[model samples]
Target: MPDLAYYASLPRTRGAAAALLLDDLGRVLLVKPTYKEGWFLPGGVIEAGESPLAACVRECEEELGLVPRLDGLVCVDWGPPRDGVDAVNVFVFAGSLTAAEIAAIRLPPDELSDHVLVAPEKVPELAPPHVSRRMEPSLRGLVEHRAVYLEDGREPGYGSAPLASAPRPGGPG
Candidate 1:
């Protein structure tokens, strides 16, 4: 948690936001926001009618332009933990996309300037405090082990491709 100043700066509630942490070969994925020069994890506020998990999945897809398998839920941070309505709960999840899948994405222009894969040491200097806190330690552990399991799950990796039936953002039956 950091300063509660931003909370007072915003309206009662900006709603909710979700975060995803993914690492590849010791490089953590990050976004250089167009709105602000600072780097950040791929995430966004949950729209009304969207579940937090759904928002986590959708934000990554929207920010990175790809749908990744959510490996696990890492941590949750709420602001009391930022002023007016200092309630921000950040859902940190372990998520990943293969090399081929990463190649297909194009960053959404309204949100980002560019995406980069950088080491943990570089993150603190490059990203915001909130983002760095969420990303750095996980990344460090991965590098130490030299191979991170990420989570307990069954994702086929880059081998056999199976069509996913995940829900599209802002759509309903």
Candidate 2:
């Protein structure tokens, strides 16, 4: 039984997935997932009819019972989709949570086991390899910038509607 990280390491098809680097104080959030047991940020595939931002918020609510305020594009990774097979498109968001927000925090336990807040610099110690590979840059960039979009070649310009749509593996527009 290969784990999600193993799948991420192997060769395979490309797809869209999202991740969240949630911050509370000076610590980032991590989860002990059901699929593989190591820690990764909260996020999942962008379901049909679902927008990227919605997916991020929903993933948090579904897994952690907290609806994170969408902080916009932090860093986008291009890779295979899923665990134990290949890498996936990991959309990491540097988001915020209020004290009132914590009051609403709930854990479903089905998707995630328990959540922990780790020091920004100590994230790699708590994060999975694939996740940490992408997380380290975004987490560090956030301290200096309000946001960071880690796409190879892309540009963010005005779009039509407010609905959050997933950009091509290239990155946020």
Candidate 3:
């Protein structure tokens, strides 16, 4: 076994959770962050001791002022270190909102400036490339009822096939 010091010396990856919320018309809900340049899914970093799902729920409420029923894991994307930043693992959970919920969305003026419901194909134009790449598998996962694992928003292999199996409750089969 590795010594405690050796284990502590291993690189650490940051965790973030986001929600893939869709409206009744199947348009995705995207939020514009006051601190960021482009639009993004409604979510933020995972705080210490918080599970991904819990963080997703909390961020949705904080950013949009709506409690969303996150259905299940849609994608687990591993982002490689880039631009001098450390690696980050982003967990995206799937959910949908009713017309009432959509109308009730209220953004925090200090954090989010606006929100919009756009077709999936239009997401690439508003969100950054990394976010856009992740959205593809996420949307497919929602329709296929399976979770996908990605590296930098794409499957590990050369093609679009999923590299990892859908996660099970107890363990992977």
TM-score of each: 0.64, 0.66, 0.86
Candidate 2 per-residue lDDT, tens place, 1-173, comes to: 75989867976434344545454575676778776758877777777677667778778878767667766667776654344755555566677766676556676766677777777667678776656666656765566664454432132344775436736577867
The true-versus-predicted C-alpha distance at residue 171 of model 2, in Å, is 25
Report the lDDT of model 3 for residue 85.
83
| Number of the top-ranking candidate, with lDDT as the measure | 3
Global lDDT of each candidate = 0.63, 0.64, 0.92
- Candidate 2 stretches with Cα past 4 Å from truth are 1-24, 80-87, 144-173
Query: What TM-score quantifies how close candidate 3 is to the native fold?
Result: 0.86
Estimate, for each residue in 1-173, the C-alpha lDDT of model 1 and write its tens digit: 96689866866544444454555664667778888769877777878677778888888878877777776555555534343545565556666667876687689887788988777678889976655665644443333533222211111244354335444489652
Rank order (by lDDT, best first): 3, 2, 1
Candidate 1: worst 10 consecutive residues by lDDT?
A: 147-156
Cα lDDT tens digits for candidate 3, 1-173? 65999878987679999999998899999999998799999998999889999999999999989889888999999988889988899999999999999999999999999999999999999999999999989999988999999999997874454535555589956
Q: Candidate 2: lDDT over CA atoms?
A: 0.64
Candidate 3: give its CA RMSD in angstroms: 5.0
Tell how far residue 36 is off in model 3, in angstroms.
Answer: 1.4
